[model samples]
Target: MTQWQTRRDDGRAGECAGGRGAASLSGGPSAATDAVLPRLILDHARDGIALLDIRGRVLWMNPALERMLGWPLDLMRGRNPAEFINLPENRPGPAELAKFRYLPGSSLFQQFRVTRHMRRDGTRFWNQQSHALIDTGRQDAQKMVVVTCRDITDQVRVQTALERMKDDLEHAAYHDDLTGLGNRKKLSQYLGSAPVRASIGTGRVGVLQLDLDKFKQINDTLGHAAGDAVLRHIARALGATAQQGDLVCRTGGDEFLLICCDVGSKAALMSRAKAILRASRAPLAWKDQTITPGISIGASLCRGTPPTPETCGGEALIAQADQALYAAKEEGRGRAFFYTPELGARYRAERQLARDLATAIEQGQFIVHLQPILHLRSGRVTGCEALLRWQHPTRGLLAPPEFLGAAAQAQLLPQIDYLAMNASLDALVSLRDQGFDDLCLSLNVSSAILADADYPALLNWAMQSRGLPPGCISIEILETSFMNRGAPDGCDAIARLRRLGARVALDDFGTGHAGLAHLSTVELDAIKLDRSMVGRLETDGRTRVIARAIIRLCRMLGMEVVAEGVETQAQIDILGRARCPLVQGYGVARPMPLAELPQWLLENKAFSLPVTLPPRDEPSPAAPPAGRARRRGDNSI
Candidate 1:
């Protein structure tokens, strides 16, 4: 029984399997019977069908093939199916497919060949094809091929779209939107993985942490957009400096992290740090102005022996780098430092101090001390400079230098300043009640406080609440505060304070950038010579000339001059000869509590006549019952 069949485009055959269908094609009496069934099914099938001769020429095709491909069967006749099929770039080409020519038809359906097929109208659709071969059992038998195809264009489009969305999501998850660098998430993921942890104990991971110095000044002076531009510029420069396999990330605002793998030695790590420092120091042009930014860098090497994933944590590395970064800033910025245990200890101490500062302010653990400022001619006390002292429950009394920096870093300066000012006012009211009405209270005001527009109102409220006149309180401002003229509320705050009958004194005058220029623009009532200038008056002849010139200039400007840090008798003699009127330092009296001031004033005749200097460490008086007692021989003030 020979099975007759037709050829297909893929060199396969579709056979009429039943004897009844075979007899119908031969036009027997039962031609319209079951013999016509195979022909009917092929013509009306949902899938496209095609036939080809053994030489790979299309011989016949079903109506479904024409509908699926949008091509007329007559025009597709004798055309090679490969010409209309669009295979992916990675798919086997004709040359590779030729190797499978001798493969048996039975194995063709093991995997359906999916590819795109073009229509006569120049459009295309995806097709899944299955192949089979047929043979005519005759002396000169001709081989035929049958190819069945299904349109899968919709499925392919959906799959491709899904893959593109997946890629987009992955890119967004790992990359920073601003800098196009790996974000914290990516860094954490990398560090937690086996690759980063494997190098922990081997000292193969070097992390350099960089923080921009004075960036806050730029942000405050310029706008946020300009700040962002600066950050992008820095990121580009830092990224350019990265070696192959090194990753740079903007881990925080004005802070960056660089992770280097397989670092050879500590010197090599430092060399990289130096390069980054140099890059950071290079001036950048923003809005037609050249701005040179300084950077402090801290580097850490992972050298955990026999490291586990948890043993060398990313946070631990970052903390070590932070400690070194703090050291760099402490030594003065624009430098780099390697992580050291000493630095870590110092950072821990500073952190603990900052943490305690908030609590200290909350608990009102601070106190006010007054140091007498004397008139140069009569040697009489005219006013007192209010100084802040921390009376720790266990540490007794601590000077401002011990905790002031930590307070400033923790943003507790405003509260502490308020505390000091209110305390000074309270002491002023106490002294006024005791007939010390002429004495003025000079209190230092931070530039940060002046930057708030609400500060003037707050100050007025404090003074009014105490029933003290505004003229009795003199605000001492640091010289450096005038360096930036663009501070939003500083200049206005000062003007408002002066308008409210408060006298403004330019404190630490000789040490800052503000010279005659700043003095000309800023309205000041008094000029306090910085200690650096005063200390040199008795020692350095040139310093004496500069001091005399400054005093003369202030006198001409109608601004009173106060010499600070006047210690030795020679210094006082020099200042008096120079015609500097007011002096404030240890030569008159050390900073003492308000309760001790009256007795000290009586014993020394500080405000009326000439006062002699007491020996260092001499006990002045006992503390009041309400106030904490002072330790004898404790001359911190």
Candidate 2:
């Protein structure tokens, strides 16, 4: 048997020697030869165990401790654990450790610590260590500490991996996948955080909302892959443009929000918005095409000595910026605007009007009104133009100018156009039944409706269902409608309508920059001089010369000319002198409801005017009576 003994600091032997020490510690048999059992058990234990004296110097170690640290017990004897173990800095010092002494009747003084320990080869690993203080019975003997250490390196590795994965998940939840920018969730969280609120309370903060204009067209035309590329590119641009501590977030598709901290004034906020606008204007090259993207920005500033959350909340700031964005779009796109209370009121009103427009459409509150188109030579009613009027139940009759802007914003113009076309066809059917079978109808269609691929088929179906000839329907498109990217589609639609035996006219001509170019590119049967030109025809000589030249050009091209807004008799005389075939305005007849058309037609059927001949440079043609001259299907007025 290997007997163990304890030596005091004074080099005196204590009572805890031989089997007596084991008996005193474990309450076992007190025989020197019997000490072998406890020693054998300790040597075979899996965990590393060590014994330290009262001053924390290591006195003895089991074989497991030697194997765990790659050091023999003899070499570590009388050494402090601090020599091999890297204890945590927060661990108790000597003074604190002295307080953890063994008390009477206590189960045993013990403590557990997880810390890193260095092996003999200088590699480090985690160890879950437990310390217990032993109480010796003899007064002359010193107390001892027993420590057991379990290797926990694998468990620590697993815990570290789990923590890393948790951090990654949190990042993904708060960021946009496509752009890698902060997302709406992150924006909301940041704005609501205590730090940001404190900053807003003491300093100025600005919220800028950016919306991509014409993004839908690019997405629809070039595919979503291109759109995603554009979004990533814009994200980088915004990140570069933002100052330190500012946050750029991709709020949604084609829209981003920037939160600026410590903004000096509203002017500084607007300047930042302008910078963003300029950044977005740069063209992006995708595949074989260059896409020039445009953005509109709206900004809202919040500042006070101590602003309340109710006044400077994230939601309120975003709402204000949105209202400013609406104003920016209203004035013109690709610009910036700051929020104001008056602008918010206007936006709210328009929003309500848009909602009411949707309800109006559902309730069938819209009606068709027609103004007679009179032949200049005969002064007789030939055909009438269709005008849309809203019979608001509470607001009374509303003109197109009142609600058309809101309807456009609501994307309801196409629906309104379809309704007007159908009603006008029905009105034409009624006129045919009332002995005006030759009466034609002209309907004004917006660019969106004109560019729609399904419009021609819908029109054909409406005309067929009403038992009206396609020749009785004329489609009038604004000159500005053909000056956009959709012009090709509009031209294709016009061709389809013409093939269906319907005549097409360029309405409000001489108002657009590309009027003459449209005349050459698009095939049309008539051109309606806009009210601006006709209103100036009598007083402006330059207008007179331009009017003469346009009429002569159309006559030579075998296209009819209609003078619109001819309110004065002198204007009619001038148009007659210019050989304008048709004239329509209040001077001829104000727009009346479909129910009043038949009576008006009856009263104007016998009206006649003096026929005017063409000038010496042009070939003169005899004027036929208005009713018989230009019937449905006749291109010539």
Candidate 3:
């Protein structure tokens, strides 16, 4: 394309510098062919070729030239090319090309375009016409000018088609298939595009990540087919309410996202969000079933040079929104809340607790509390379960529920195991020194640590190095953790732990879909029924039935069952009579402080075990029953 463009001294468009005369340009060679040789020279060129005489007349033009210009030779000849074909005679450029003036006395060529060139029939096509002057290799030869015209209409049409397709493909790449809205991938890409304050003066762009509350439960109860329908309907509702040019995406299951742009104010943005919520709350009908979906929305401003989605990044906007959403659920459902500076400060405090918890074991901030698990039949203190607690000095006895929450949020399950291991070891040493032999102390274990390949070595080193009997130290892994049915090496971790002489307690049984299967391979020494199961047992027969089944299942496996959260004496009498051997509960004692537990042991030293069994020998009426009617006169069984 780097042609030798000849420019006039005055900066006008000119033809190529190395222009050849007709004889040299083509040599079909006949003396008779010589006079019309320039015509022949122009005839076969691919680009439209036209020759215009100095009088502004089209003296001759080629077949390709006529086709390009949409003109015939009969109509074109003897008329000025300009009269037939129109152009912007006064284009802004160098004086000579603008005026169509030739350079003085030289073999000059010019390439100038006609803005609107017309055909012989008055139809127009765009042309990029080039003009050149030639010498006949004779002294008095008239300067013959050659004009070449090329049509660019089809090229323009194809280019237009390609541009449209490019836009469409780009849209397809980033949009959700069903919603015709931005997908997560496109949202991420758009987040990457540097957000700048438009001089057009729209307010800042903010993102709201709204996940439907209890969505999974709904999906499970109703069916994912209905779940998918609800999701689509909600998406449609929210999409209809979204601002023009605003983006909406279904990030994942039942989580729809909004990228709000050009709002007038925060209040206006809030209104938009409220609209979405209202739209979602409207009942959706699918396959003759009507259901209402509730949305929990977290909105945050993208406040930087290139604002990324706070919703998508770690501890970023999503966490803020999520915490706020959860807080809304805590206060009540069917509500919306904004994350404020106070919430952030509270989150910072919680996160600090989570982070400090990393070194909790290393710094000896965590300690174990041993609450005695009494045998229902034996009427003796059989064992104690090691409940992990953070004895945060300044904070003062932070319960497992407090820091454990943040630990789960931070996804620090391994940290819990690490701390719990040391805490368990220390408790074993303490229990041994206290002459509490033949007593089993259980420590809670997370599924994450159990899934670790090196968990056995870690547990062994902690237990064996401390001269702790693996039999005396039971590790309580949650029942739900072992329920990954098709997991690679499923339950293999627990099997390894059992081989290491550590008894695994299936903590929180009856909490998941897989109940029996969890106990099958878990090799549990015990099962602790969750408090939810226990709390409703007196009222809900179904709960009592499940507890009875769980107790029977544990007994069948030769495993002891510990019913947790035993608050009422009735609960105790229920389990005691059912002969569910061992139980730990608030009715017996709340998780006492490690310091207070030893004292609790001493205070309850003359422990008339609150257990039931048929006497080995018949008790004479004369001899007082061990638990006196006054031990009953205190009237708290």
Candidate 4:
């Protein structure tokens, strides 16, 4: 029979080269036939193969074994196989496999798990040592074992993948997908089913709801991509700001709910809040855009009750946090506020105040405060704008912030509008009969009135009945009213009023982002710069520079300029330098009723001012020739 010895091509590992064994076997088999079988098996083997003697000497090997182990088969003769062949620790090596009990007369297959095995150059492969014992009755009638190996590296990789999927599935079940924080379901499970603590404990649960301010504006104006970027940035910041016991989650879009378990001290919670605020203010570097995101946070502490601190309702905590968030926004953005009993009281008070407003309006608790509008060119009291003030009996006199929202809710806007409109029109008609020529009255009109089909007819009837000049009455409109230009019959109402001889002036201009854009679209006779812009104009000389630029722009567009909310003489001085055509605010006169109109006229003796025209004043171009301008400026009774 023939035996084989195997070694690597590099002369270090085993290569099985088939060789004839001269020994004769006792099994009734021919010696030549047995030798042919060993040679045939070694040459046809797929893996590198080898044969070893009892003394661990490599006698024969195949060509595949030499290439597989990087060793030459010839060089491996008479060497200890254990010294050169590597074995894995967890499995049997060649020496261990040789100890397998076997009958020398019979052929048997034995597999030795490779504890560790190495290449000729010392690299490793997972190997399985497969062998069989056979008896050859030659050379003292000895028995031999033949061995082969196959690599299993790719199988190990597949096994690792299956393990990872199992781990990921387990994680996804209890954590939020967006932020990897504990989800609401997990929170409910923990608070509901978790074990208890001692009767006396420091277990407080602080839940905070954080909302991103101006996030919707980014979504609407810059596309949802920007909005998503902002959300992800917020998630990262809040996650890092949280404590070991705190969990932060994205409750929904642009809203993060943080849960701090066992937070007992107010000082500790405040410290945590300061950390969150600092992190939220960090700049978000996304897609080359650095966005400084602002967060409004509302925090509420759950009351503790006995063993395990009886858990508070999650919905109640969320609601309290939401109210706190709203208050934070009202106070200004980028802040964390705790929900307190005082805040709860304020909430109840404001809610009740909002409800009582409609009744107040219907009861005629709303009065008109007439602020005098002065002619800039001649410095004469040309008109007055009827500003609405609400006199709530219990709440005292409330301004626009008080009743404006309620008027909209009760659908009493038209009623409120008519009240102010008629009162000013009646007073003007009375003043005209008292020989005040060319006197004008300006009343604020909502887009609601323009939407009314009878608005043009309504104003015409009132003007004709009073024998008043149609051109002497003007309506003030906000610049933002045209934002919804897509409305049906867009601006048709404003156009009809123009056709009815009522002039229109744009009010609160320069306060909106699209203020300049609205100017060319609407046919405005004058632009009233808003208080913020006027107040801004004082601090920022650049603001007046912009104001001058706007004045230049209005002049190019053939529109007049009116400066609103001019309280101080300095504001008037600035307006004078800008050559504003009109000014209205306390710097001129306070709003009074019809009975006081003649008294104001007598005190100013406005009629004589244009005759002694100040060096800086220019008589209005609207003033007729010389005599009319003189009489209108004549302030004496």
Candidate lDDT (C-alpha), each: 0.75, 0.80, 0.66, 0.68
Q: What lDDT tens digits, residue by residue, belong to model 4 across residues 160-192?
A: 688888888867877777557666666665545
Model 3 lDDT tens row, 400-485: 87887688777886877687778767876876678655556777777677777898888888877888766666777765566542
Top lDDT: which candidate number? 2
User: Ten consecutive residues with minimal summed lDDT in candidate 4?
Assistant: 628-637
On TM-score, who's better, 1 or 2?
Answer: 2
> Which candidate tops TM-score?
2
Ranking by lDDT: 2, 1, 4, 3
User: Per-prediction TM-score, please?
Assistant: 0.82, 0.82, 0.60, 0.50
Write model 2 residue lDDT over 1-637, tens digit each, in one string: 2435644445555333233122342233342234454675676678999998866678998877888888888887876666655545544566655554435344434456888877888778898987787779655148787889899999999999999999889989999989989998899789878877776876577899988888888888999999998898788779978988788999989999999887868999998888887888788999999988888889898844466665566678788898898788888899999998788788888899899899998999999999988876656677899899999888899999999989988999999988888888888888888888667899998987876888899999988888877777788988777666466776788899899988999889998556777778888889999999999987899999999999989888878888999898889888888888788999889999988989888877755554464555665333354446354324332
Show where candidate 2 strays beyond 4 Å: 1-41, 53-68, 71-75, 80-112, 116-124, 135-143, 199-203, 220-226, 241-246, 281-292, 303-311, 615-637
Candidate 4 accuracy as lDDT: 0.68
> What's the true lDDT of residue 382 in model 3?
51
Please identify which of the two predictions, 3 or 4, would achieve the higher lDDT against the true structure: 4
